[model samples]
Target: MVAILGCCDSTNPVRRDGGLPGSVPAPSPGALRAEDQLPRQRRSLTSEDRSAIAVGVTCGCSYAQIGAMIGRDKSVVCREVTRNRGPDGSYWAPVAHRAAHERRRRPKPVKLAANPGLCRRIEVAMDEGWSPGLIAAMLRHEHPGTSAAARMGRVSHETIYQALYVQTRGNLRADLHRQLSLKRSARKSRGSTGRGGSHTYDHALTISQRPAQVADRAVPGHWEGDLILGRGNRSAIGTLVERSTRFVILLHLPGRRHDAPSVAQAMITEMSKLPAHLRRSITWDRGSELADYVDIQLNLQAPVYFCDPHSPWQRGSNENTNRLLRFWFEKGTDLSTHTPDDLARIAATLNARPRPTLDLKTPTQALHELLANPPAA
Candidate 1:
């Protein structure tokens, strides 16, 4: 018998019995092979590959060995095993494969749907007039763990928003969107085009002269104040947000008495209830309602600072709080209808809502901590 070596006809070089000496034997012409069915360039793992991986894992083969058996990179094998493993830390081929399919399916179940506990928490927060971002942050803040449900609870802010705005994404309550600060059925472009009327506060201290500490919000007492006007600008509510804690205090400027004296007195009465340390500085826009800022400074003993004309962003915390207050006190409504007690309740509700800026702590909690510790001047 002649031995064939490296000839085109005997490229695979088999023994007399027809088995390749040092390599896998060629499949029979009519026989199907596992590798033959796999696409030449597969984007994802196939059932056959998963089956091979399962067998390899059961036999204690290394990831590289398993990948070699399945014609995939070692990292690919590693990721597949790591991600699709069962809860008990076992990698079952069938379960993993099913999970992979579920993941690949378009419009997979909404996280908030499968997780009712998470949905309830989200709904409660939304109902409390919390922003989606705030609710998301608070969820993450409270559930800082690696458990399955904890992981589910850590949905992104955009996810909570989609649950509210996108009809099909989550199991959140239908009316929960109305509980949002904006109370809008759909999102709108976020911007403000209304310009503040130019006013000269010749004797007022501009935000430029404000201390560096106030701008950075390092010390706990600095505040930002503004008036959210009602119908025809006849009635208004004064809003004060602590720059550090975002703690809100709503002034009941009832009977359309949002004049300079009324606003100043309302602010003084509400803010004076705090310890002097918690009443450090006040920053305001150039609104005429705050014309008697001097009286506020004298009574509260906190110097009032003014933002530059037409620059609402300068008092960002206050601007944001005003927008939130609008949820309870809508524009074009009679502000006087909400009495002092009503205003107090609304303010309490707002201060109780968690703020994203305050590390998911409610402004009330942050303020309490500040009061308890009382940061130095």
Candidate 2:
């Protein structure tokens, strides 16, 4: 039987009479040169190397360093340690060394190299309705040692997502795919509404025509607004935010009936609360609620700029504000349960949370600072 180099032989070959002997072939000159050109492998670990690896492992060195010392890949080292050492806890050198030696003799392919257990745990958590981000954070917190350091035992939330979407990984557990909020598929972008499309009201200004200062968000008076719908589209809350300060304001829409009159009234009432200096312009999408936008502009004395239809990014501040609002006013709930006062309290809470974008300052502090020393005319 002739055995091919670097190739698998699955069938047993029967002896044939008068056949050439299946002798191993000598290396060709090219192969010899290739082998000679390769870098020399270190035969034994130096004291310094061992010390460094020991220190690293003790001080939470990643599996990568351990593998480098042993002349193996990081995932191989991780699997050896995870499979041999305390599967329940942290890695110890003696146990890890023994595991590595045993694994070298009989290697096993990993289904999910980065934390098979952790991945399973994450799947369980997702089944229980936890988000991927939340699961990642919890793993880092709960299993600090193994979950935080490893090529085979630790993975980011993004990795979890990629594994689910990318087909090459071989779906080990298809059930895990169900945990994703959005199914894996190309998303259809919304069509752009023209700059001159129908407006919430006659003679309304388009976002493109808004002042340069508003676009730059250097001025504190520029505001963006939107609505979040509740279950059955019968309940909703109006959300507005100051672009510069991220200051949030929420309005309780008693019923989901966001008609022109009701929406315009809400805008007027909210804008009326701010001083004239803080009411420069308002940006909104082409929702029917803003049909009476002319009334809002006239009553509030602030220009109303309409975003192109289906373009949520046009009112970025309001879009971001709505995301934060979701933390409190979740989707598919009866938003009408909250009163104007309740909505005000929710807005106040959000304004008090520190924002990294705002130099870790709470929106309240940022807004107060802006109001304290108003930008020069």
Candidate 3:
């Protein structure tokens, strides 16, 4: 029977109404399975994938044909066509494609974007010589009545540093780079020597020998001090910052060569103004400016501890304070031009600014509180 069936078609094929050809028997309606009637399986389309397909169609593929190719519903293709259509009634394929590509390529949005107006205000504050940390606290305090979403709340100084140093995505203004404190060259890696050199003052104490209470900041009077050298090595300013309060005191050095005697006399004179209990150990780097460390210790009745050579972190409070100081006295500028009154004004500004780390209190506030309640004898 099978041989007859095969031979019959080869010899005299029967013609169908549509064309002259041998026709295969169609499946009966009841015999056709549900699975057989279903469309072929296709890979699922993600939001991104759908966007791409939409762009591709807008560029010029027929809706039914694209649906067949991508295994999507024909209606999905039609909706995509309608959604991305321009105001001119034209479906711009290239524009849609570019938009999709850029959307997929974007990085996570910045926290600053939450309140752009606030960021601009913070930038203005920076231009006025306020530190990022200070600006962040001011935003929270001054704008308490504003909506939290609208306010530029607390952001760390480090966060501001990252935005300034790390290039922003889609940022068109390269000139904005100037707003950063450190130039790109300053960000490069540099090797540092350990605090190995010995100071000329024989009686000076090592930082390791400082009292446990001082190291832990349990008591309020311990301080870190250093010198900010200016151009020509002829001019310099002595800086002192209380560890607990971060209160800064700028010393007026008469001349570079007079630094030893001048720093010693300045420490004695300024520290004497504070109550006896407020004068504790002072930490300093091994710079020659402090060659008269013994005299400073003797006059103030406070031990002077020398940090390791080239170890700025040991006197981190002073180092951080110096960075803030740069806004007034920039690097490479002659410090001789600044008088004692000018330096004092800068120090006053720093002390008055609120510090986030100090619970949004100004250094002056912390210092006043310390003064009101002296430490136990």
Candidate 4:
């Protein structure tokens, strides 16, 4: 034998048999070799990577050992496990991977995160119970000129809202959401006769009295209205739909009642948000729930019109939207269970949705355009 032991198999200097040694065993025949497939550039773990981790964990592999197997730094594996565990704190592969996907999707830096002043303004307004839309308008109103407005951090309500719902962006504190009137983890649609309520109106301006311009939908301010009732008509929500822009507003009411006074107050607080030009008129059904119509007309300075008795069609836009709202406030559920902040979130969702009437523009976009170039009152 001519000194047969020359660097453990001579030709191959880095063989597992003698060199640095194998970190991981060769993949079992046909096993998914996804460990090396994770995107190195983005620093995000892929679903396939998660599946491999599950296999490694099942096989009693330690984190450092697993990191070696996957060609990743041990610290990276450590962070992934700590950050993306499930609600139960168990590192189930599927749940951890799904959460990673949600966290990795932060497409833009949140407006509140970018501007400290804007963040402060939002926090103050939220504490005062102002909706995100109201905060946005206030920012614009205070900084009127276009260039000055941009410089002053005049962001849209949609942007403020984006921070709240998307997991990847946490510019707004999670506790601040509790300060919002309705506090739902997710939004719900609202409307009901079967889904929400109905009341009869007396001595009210009839929809027939509404102006021709209002009927044509050419102008931006005209709105249609209705209510979604809760179980046995005990609880309710006030819903308003803009005829031209197809925008929606939801009113949070007294938990047990959508009474005339309560409904009127809710509408007053919500509608007071619009500029004078955008407060032209509101057409609703003759449901007695709006017995405070005269008060709404006088105080809002926006006239109110009633639909003919038993005819939901007179408030067609409102009627259609109410049905769509049924997806959230189902007929037999307790409407009172939802908070005002919940209604605000739901309205945001409704406004952000694309509408066929507005050439596929979202109600939020159509409203934005209208706000930019409103028609003469």
Q: Residue 170 in model 3: shift from native, Å?
A: 18
Q: Tens-digit lDDT track for model 1 on 1-377?
A: 11111112344333432233564543332333355644435678877778667755654557865554455677998999999887677888788889899888986777887888888887777777787888778888988987876887679888888887888888888788777655678876434424334454788898999999887888888989888887877788888888888888888886788888898888888898999988889998887778788888888999999887677889988887888787788877888788889988999998888877778889889878877786444
Tens-digit per-residue lDDT, 121-174, candidate 2: 767788887877887777566555744254444456765665566554433366
* Per-model lDDT: 0.77, 0.66, 0.67, 0.73
By summed lDDT, which 10 consecutive residues of candidate 3 come out lowest? Answer: 1-10
Q: What is the full ranking by lDDT, best candidate first?
A: 1, 4, 3, 2
Poorest lDDT segment (10 consecutive residues) of candidate 2: 11-20
Judged by lDDT against the true structure, how good is candidate 1? 0.77
Better of 1 and 4 by lDDT: 1
Across 261-284, the per-residue lDDT of candidate 4 in tens digits comes to 998998999899999888899988
Model 1 misplaced stretches (Cα beyond 4 Å): 1-200, 375-377
Q: Residue 172 deviation, candidate 1, in Å?
A: 27
Q: Could you give me the TM-score of model 3 versus the true structure?
A: 0.51
lDDT of 1 at 255: 73
CA lDDT, candidate 4, residue 226: 87
lDDT of 3 at 76: 68
Best by TM-score: 2
TM-score of each candidate? 0.49, 0.53, 0.51, 0.47
Q: Model 3, 145-256: lDDT tens per residue? A: 4444544465556566666656762222244446556544224433343222353745668888888887777788898998787876677888999998899988887655
The C-alpha stretches of model 2 lying farther than 4 A from their native spots are 1-203, 375-377
Instruction: Kindly give the stretch of ten consecutive residues in candidate 4 with the minimal lDDT sum.
Output: 1-10
Of 1 and 3, the candidate ahead on TM-score is: 3
